[model samples]
Target: MKYLKNSTDTNYSMFLTNPEVICRKIGNGFFLLSSKKTWDKCPYVQQISETGAFYWNLLEKGIQRDEMLDCFLREYNIMREEASEDLDYYIDMLIEYHYLTKIE
Candidate 1:
């Protein structure tokens, strides 16, 4: 599968606030706590499940998708195919919500 550079992700300046949420500015995207409060304010916020949140946290550290998929497959005791499908679905949702952007 093809992957875009981290730099192609969207600028999330409008979505973040509060120091306690623990945010890290990556190339363009940011990884932050998916808290209820944050979700409340940005109703469009992509609501990721716990597993999805785990991958998001890892991505913040510059981990790539393959590595994250490997970890999730091992940690969740799931098949690689299942992991990939879930990952793709959530990532697409994030993109659709403007939390992520493609590098055109």
Candidate 2:
């Protein structure tokens, strides 16, 4: 796991989908598959939970990081700190796997 980036930069809306990644709805969750161009980077299929699908859609639509935090808290029975931490980690993993690109 990478160190969480809980920065205060208001401009950091964070990860959006990478061009070569495909998101497909599967039941209540989602499947993340790397395109041919990204096969060398991350070739495995990623199965995500329904909660992850929610965030994935949000990020795909360019939702702000703060809004993401609020959504997590409102939708799940978790503390704000836990939501923030978990979201940060999920965003980090998406980037690591080439499924998402961090907006500069």
Candidate 3:
């Protein structure tokens, strides 16, 4: 499975509007607000779960999956197999959606 790595702090910029994180059940989608740009134009906006948002934030800090998995294992107390499966699923989804670029 492919994954992201080595992301730098420079890669991400904060949303100026401090966008409200809202989940829309109708479309099963997430949206954000932008204070820095025009209504139709904004930064790279994407819909992701709260957990995914957490991991994405960590990725911006250059955290790797191994480290994330360690944290997840400790926090969730789940089996390694289960954790690996879930991580792989999320990574695959991110890559498929073009939100993540595979390094190698």
lDDT of 3 by residue, 48-81 (tens): 6656655555544556676767767776767988
**Where does candidate 3 have its weakest 10-residue lDDT segment?**
14-23
Q: Which ten residues in a row have the lowest lDDT in candidate 1?
A: 11-20
* lDDT head-to-head 1 vs 3, winner: 1
Instruction: Score residue 38 of candidate 2 by CA lDDT.
Output: 78
* C-alpha lDDT of candidate 1 relative to the true structure: 0.53
Q: Name the runs in model 1 displaced over 4 angstroms.
A: 1-46
**In model 2, where do residues sit more than 4 Å from their true spots?**
1-14, 27-29
Model 2 CA lDDT for position 4: 19
RMSD list, candidates in order:
9.5, 4.8, 8.6
- Compared to the true structure, candidate 1 yields what TM-score? 0.56
If both were scored by TM-score, which would come out higher, candidate 2 or candidate 3? 2
- Clashing pairs in model 2, backbone N/Cα/C closer than 3 A: none
Q: Which residue runs does candidate 3 get wrong by more than 4 Å?
A: 1-47
